[model samples]
Structures are given as structure tokens and as C-alpha cells.
Target: MAHWFHRNPIKATNAVTFDFGGQASTPLARNICSEARSARSNLLTIFADPTRDLTVLTDAAEKYLSILRGFVEPTVDPNSQRPPAQAPNSEGGEVESMEVSSSATGDSKLRNAIKFTWSNTLAEKHSSQHDFVFEQINILFNIALWHTKHAAALAGAKEDIAEDDAKEVHKCLRSAAGIFNYIDDKLTVKLFERTGDGTDLDPNIIKAYAQQCTAEAQEVTVARAIELKHASNLVSSLAFETGKQFKIADNSLKAVEENLVQKWRKYLQLKATFYLSYAHCYNGQTLLAQDKCGEAVRALKESKTQFEKADDLGRSYTSTKGAGKSAKPHEHAFFRRLLPLVRRNLEKVERENGFIYYQKVPEVVPELPSKATYGLASPVEFVMPSKHEDWTAETYNGFKISKPDAEKREKEKDDAPKPVKEVPVNQTDKESSNSSGCTIS
Candidate 1:
């Protein structure tokens, strides 16, 4: 479990007192700053061990986010750094994977009062910004990572995973995907600038992470179906969809620098291939059930070929250089147990074809399933936490913002075209749940 998932390191930052109160320090202002720091401290401490109780990890993350919202609430600026016309925060003309808000990205005096510094997930140099949105971005990113770690812990907690544990594992990965999507959708677009190489803020990296988490979550569901002895077609469909998700995730990394994520890519690639094998193996079972033993043999042969490819990729993944810790997915029974099952099915189908059905093996391979109908995983859409009550109107206007010089403000207006936002993902994802932000459906 320790090295099951690759995690970005916790960002290190120099502590800054959020003292926007200046000379007229109201009691509320001091309290706000104090509470903000305390919230941040608790979040950092909790992140140290993501394998703890699911509730504890999520609560800590959300608490910091809620209070931080008060600091980043929109403020008017004649010389806004963003474009006059707001655009979507999406790419490649796909549906907006995240909810894009029209609220102004804060250019407030308090926003620049405290600078936030965070190191890259790799050992690369860090990105530092005086903007409050920068802090929010880092917080949201780490929150997503914490959810992934929690999912990994649950999945590998024991060899024989309980039904409840599997459910939680599935839920956590979807939640993680939601957060990563949020960062890509809402927060990162608000940054004045991103000034670090190999930073986690890269859109391709975010998408890759999001896709991988979703695929991984679906993996748990597939295991559950198999464990419960679900119908062969159902399992095949689920496995096929899971592998497709992983492939999409792998393809997203094409634009990313290979040295930064070769191992990570290999891991995703093997998972993709491994799941394809699982799909074919189960598919062969389904074919055998229909007495199409010849077609079953063909599917099982393809399954065996995919399994071999995955095994070779597994060895390469272990040896490849990359950022983050190594993963031992091949060591898991969830992965190792598939080949024997495939072999057994192949043997049975070949014997049955010779004796019973007598159908000839076609010249071409049979088609693998296109997708899963019942258990295809999607991101558990994330909603940003509402501002804490401490950010009430009276408390909010208490601190006077230091006005920026007109010349400097004018100079800082970025002429860059705003990101075009895409359609929102489940804008209606409102359901009450105790697991984490959104209920696992």
C-alpha cells in the first residue's frame, strides 16, 4: 500500500501572517488571520498521513478551503489582469469537465499581502506568488492527492478487501478525480501566472491524474463484480471500459515531458493492457456460455497476448525512471490472478470447441466490448466550499486593502487571451453524503 500510488509531495511554504488589518487591526481581523493559519496548519498536519480516517482527511481539507474562500472573493479593479470578456477554462473543445464561475479572480490588496511558496511534486524548483488564488490552487491540488492516497490505502489494506472497503476505495478515486478536474476547471485559470517547470499545475498532468483516478476507481467496481460472481458479460463490459479509461489517461501524457513521467506512463499503460486482458478473459467466458467455443478460443488467445504485453510493461515500469515513488501493481492479486484465470478459460474453451460446438475460429479476432453500462466510473463532481461565517460582511470590510499604484496596475494587465470554458460536468451534482464532498452514487 505504501508505494501502490504515485503521490505528488506536499508543497513546502514559508509561513506568512495574513495581517491585512494594518494599523487599524480590528479584533475580527486578528481572529481571521489566526483562524486562517490554524486551518492551514491542521491541513498540512493531516496531509502527513492520508491513510487515516476518510472523514478526518476530507474535513481538514475542506475547513482550510472554506476559510480561504473569504480571502479570494472577487474584488473590482479598473485594470483587471484578465480579459474583459470571460471565457471557459476548458481545452480541445470537449465538454467543460469543471464548473466555471464568472466571479472575478481576486486582485484585492489582501490577495497580494501574503505570498505563498510551494515546491514542485518533483524535486524541481518551486512556484511562488503573492496572489491568494495561488494558495487556493495549491490547497486544492494537494486535497486531490490526499484522496488518491486514501483510496490506495483502502485498496491495499488487506489481500481480501471487504465490500465496504471496496466501495470506499471506488468513492475516493472519483472524488480525487473531481478535485483535479476542479483545479483544471476553476482555479488554475485564475492564476496571474504559473512560473515553474514540472509543476503539478500542468493541464496535461492534471487531466492524466484525473483520468487515472477514474479508471482506478472503476477497477475496484470490476473487482467487486467479479468477487460477487456477476454475469460474464457484465464483468467483461466493466473491464473493457476500465482499460479504455486508462488508455485515455496514457494518451493525455503525450504532450508532457517524458522524463518527468515515464514510469508513471508505463504504470498507466500496463494497467490499460492488463484490464484489456481481464475484459477478454471474461468475454471468453461469455462466449463459451453461448456455445461459441471457437470464438471463445479466439478471445482467450487475444486475452493471453494482452496479458503478456502487460507483464512486459510491468517489468519496464519497475525499472523506468520517473518522479514520485514506485508502484508494485503486479504484486497485487487483483493483477496476478487474471492470467491463471485466462489460461483456465482458454483450456476449457479449446476443449469444448473440439468436442461440442465445432465452430471454426474466424480469420480475424472477435471485437472486445466497447463500454460498461452499469459501473463505468466518472469523477465525483467537486463543489468549492462556501465561505466560513467568519467572512460575514462586517468582518470582510473591516480590513482596508492597500491600493496598488496606477502605473504598476496598468503595466500588469496581461493581454493573454482568456481560456475558453467548456460545458460543466453535472452542474446538478447535488446530493447529501457523509463520505466526502459528494455522495458516491
Candidate 2:
């Protein structure tokens, strides 16, 4: 279970005390900056291990992000925008006052001179910037990653997980999805520029992470439906949707570095194939329940094909090189648990088709059941927190910024590369002895 998730590490950084010029009249700015930095440090350094408490890490993330908001525009007041960085994501979206340089925001007068240095998770190297927005984006990425880690912890618990724990798993994943969505929908457009694949702020990486979380959350929904013994159609519908979700996530990373992302892509591929098997297996059950022996026999055969494909991926997912721990999903009981069920169902249907129904098995597999009508996962709504009360415009405007290199800005604008976009795949199904998610590995 430790290897269940291929988590991206947080941006590491050296410390900086927010020491400003001696002209300041108040300690208010210093205190807020110090606490914000401390919270950030604490958040980044948390071990990526799943054994840690979820609530502790979650609170620390919010505390840091809310305080850091003070140093930026529109968050601190109706007006505090900063000067433009190298360039915007021009791939398209909302660009705030970030593009418009105006002294009225006190943006030109008080550049927050404290240089924030942070490492890129994939690049495994540090890049320093005077940008508060840089800190914001990185901090948001870490918190979202933490939620995925917590979901793993809950699912990987040594004891059988309780129903409430399943709910927590669902909640944690959706929370991760929401933060990632916020990054794509709101924050990335505000980025002075795309940090490229070397950095987590790259749009394609964000989309992949967002889709994975949303898909993983639905895996929980599938497990819950089975535990509750929901209808055959509902279970098959959900399982089909889960497979589709995993495909989208895998597709999002199509052009990401193979050395960096191949293992994760393999995990998505295996899961997609696994859940397609589930969808087929259950759709077969739905058909059997409705006495459509011909379709049931056909669907079961399709499930067998997908199941074999997932079994093949299990090995590759283990061998593939990439960041984070490699999962032993092939060996995990959760993965093998479906085989007996599929076999039993397929055997039953084939026997019935021959003796009772006398229906002919068709060559074509039935189309995948329609998308689930309900109980699918959606991102929890996320809005940037209001700036901490202590960070009034007066306190924020006191500090000046370290200006970005104008030359480098122009160069990056000319040199920025197009983003990588890929297609994806995925797993999970029923008659389980217990209720838990597939991502638990």
C-alpha cells in the first residue's frame, strides 16, 4: 500500500526571513511574513509517507496560503496587483491586473523584496524568484498532493477500513481535484508564465493530476455501490465511468517526459483496463439479471479480455521508472479479488446460455454502459481565502519587490515551448469481501 500512489514531491527551498528596509514603522508585516514562511516550510517538509495525520497537514497548508495572500494584489485589497513576470500562459484564459502595470496598486512602489526560492518537483532542482505568485502556485500544488497522500493512508490502513474512512478517502480525493481545478481554471492563467514541465505549474501536468483525482474518487464510489449492493445497472454504469475517467487522465500526460511520467502513465493504463473489465463484468451481470443471455455471454468475454490486459500492465507498472514508490498492485489482494468474481459470473452465464437460454454469443462486445447518472465525483468548490486581516494595504505596501529580469522575460516569451498533451486509461470492480478503493494498491 505504501507504493499505491506515485506522488510528486513538494517544491523544496532554503529559508529566508522577510527582512525589509529599516524604514518600516511596524512589526506587523514582519510577523505575518515570518509566520507565512514558517507555515510554508512546515508544509513542504512533511514526509510524503501516508502514515501521517491528514488534518494536521491540511491545516498547515491553508494557514500558509491565506497569510501569503497578503503579499499579492486583489487578495490583500481591491487593488494590489504586481508587475508582469516573463509572460502569461497565452495558451488562453483570464489574466488579471498582472498584465497591466499600474502604480495605483502600489505594485511599482512596494515590490515585496523578499526573494522566494523553490525547487521544481520533477526537475529536482531549485529556481529562485522574487515572485509571491510563485510561492502561491507551489503551495497550492503541495496541498493538493497531500490530499492524495492522505487518501492513500486511509485506504492503506492495516485494519479493514470503516465506512467513514471510505467517505474520508472520497473527500480527500475530491479536495485534491478541486485544488487542481482551481490551479487550471484560475491560478495558472495568473501565472506570470508557464514554468514548463520542469515545474508543477505546467498546465498539462495540472490537468493530469486533476483528472486522476476525480477518477480515483469515483473508484471509491464504485466500491461503495458494491458494498451497499446497488443495482446491477448502477454498478456497471459507475464502473464504466471510472474507466473513462482514468483514460482521460492518462491522455492528459501524452507528451510528458517518459522517464519522469511513464510509471504513472502505466498505472493509469492498468487501472483503465482493469475498470473496463469491471464495467464489462457487471454489465454482463446486468444482462444476466434481465435474462439477455446472448449479450451477457458477449459482455463476459469482453471482461475477460480487459482483465488479461490489466494483468499484463500489472508487471509493467511495477517495472516502469518514475517518481514516487512503485506499487505492488499485481500482488495486492485488492487487484486479484476481482478475478474469482468475473470467473464465477462468466461461468454461470456461459452455462446458462448453453442449457437454458440457448442464445448465441455474438462476436461484438456490447457497447460500454452509459455514464453513471449519479454518485460520480466532482471537485469540491474552492475560492482563494480572503487575505489575513493583519495584512492591510498599508502593511503590504510597505515592502518593495525584487524586479524580474526584463531581458530574460523577453527571451522566455520568444522561447516558451508548447505544452505536452496525451491520452489515458484505468481499474476496479465487485463481489468484494470488503469495501475499499483500487488506488490503495
Best of the candidates, lDDT: 1
Per-residue C-alpha lDDT of model 2 across residues 1-441, encoded as one tens digit per residue? 112445555445556665554423357656776777677667666634444678777677667777777666532445635432332234564323332453454342233345566666566545655567776776787678767877776776543568888888899899989999997887667555566574577677888899999989999889888888898889899989988998999988887777767777888898889899989999999999889999999998889889999999988877777765545566666678788889999999999998999998889888877778989999897778776777775565444333345665545322221211111101222333543233432
The residue-level lDDT of candidate 1 at 48 comes to: 58
Q: Please, what are the lDDT tens digits per residue for candidate 1 over residues 1-441?
A: 111445445555556566554622467767888899898887777765656798897788778888888777743333544422222323533322111232333343356556677756643556667678899988877777777777766655555667787778788889989989999998888787966446778888889989989988888878878888999999999999988999999998888777877877887899889889989999999888887788899999999999999988977776777765454455444556778899999999989888878899976778876666798888999998887877754465455543345566445423322221111111111121221111110
TM-score for each candidate, following the candidate numbering: 0.81, 0.82
| Candidate 2: C-alpha lDDT | 0.70
List the candidate 1 regions with Cα displacement exceeding 4 Å: 1-4, 19-24, 74-108, 404-441
What's the lDDT for residue 144 in model 2? 81
Error of 2 at 331 (Å): 1.0
